[model samples]
Target: MENRPKVGIGVIIIKGNKILLGKRKNTHGEGSWCYPGGHLEFGESWEECSRREVWEEVGIQIKNLRFGTITNDIFENEHKHYITISMISDYESGEVKLMEPDKFDKWEWFEWDKLPSPLFLPTINQLKEGFNPF
Candidate 1:
């Protein structure tokens, strides 16, 4: 097996005072909540990846996406990861549905003040600290 830092992109899809979250499925953190996102494809732009991830994970099309945050982490001594960028979008179209039904158990919109406990760590950090991607 090869070792390399995995890179990903995510988005905080905003609507009014709420954000969209997906319930994770089939992983160690099964049932934990997280924003919509995933790994970038080879040669894909960040914006394109973000849009693709949102659609792939949530079955929605988003617009007015803007940069929000970047996160870096190292895990279990050897596994490293970088969330190169996270975008926030004000507009989304289509009914909410799980594109990868096995990967995500469900989806919901939640008020920021009333988010579920034990969110995906990187997302929780970004929400708490208000990251600026300048």
Candidate 2:
């Protein structure tokens, strides 16, 4: 899907002292850690996409959604480019689960200063963009 830059939503769900992340599987960023998120659907708002992706991927809900930052991530190897809409949100409810096991290996929470290795490209770009949840 390289016709043009597609829009994606990457939500950083914040807890008391940690945030939710998932290990990518069977996709572009396979084996890399990333925030709970997915592509922006047609006729949907960014806020809606943030909550939807989190629930769809991790079986959890998020609130207080606010703009975090944006990244123009170009996956050269996959020949795909995306304008990632980063959303910062507070953990709302529900237990985290591998709702889409095929897309993610497992879900985990990590301190802002202590994250897992091999972050997804869009995630790495978010950090490079100076966007912080803490």
Best by lDDT: 2
lDDT of 2 by residue, 101-123 (tens): 88889999999889899999988
Candidate 2 residue 103 C-alpha distance from true site, Å: 0.8
User: Per-candidate TM vs. native?
Assistant: 0.85, 0.95
Clashing residue pairs in all predictions, respectively, total 0, 0
Name the lDDT value of residue 40 in candidate 2: 96
User: lDDT (0-100) at residue 35 of candidate 2?
Assistant: 92
Badly placed stretches (over 4 Å) of model 2 are none
Best by TM-score: 2
Tally clashing residue pairs in candidate 2.
Answer: 0
Q: Write the per-residue lDDT of candidate 1 for residues 68-115, one digit (tens) a residue.
A: 878764444334555546788864688888789989888899887788
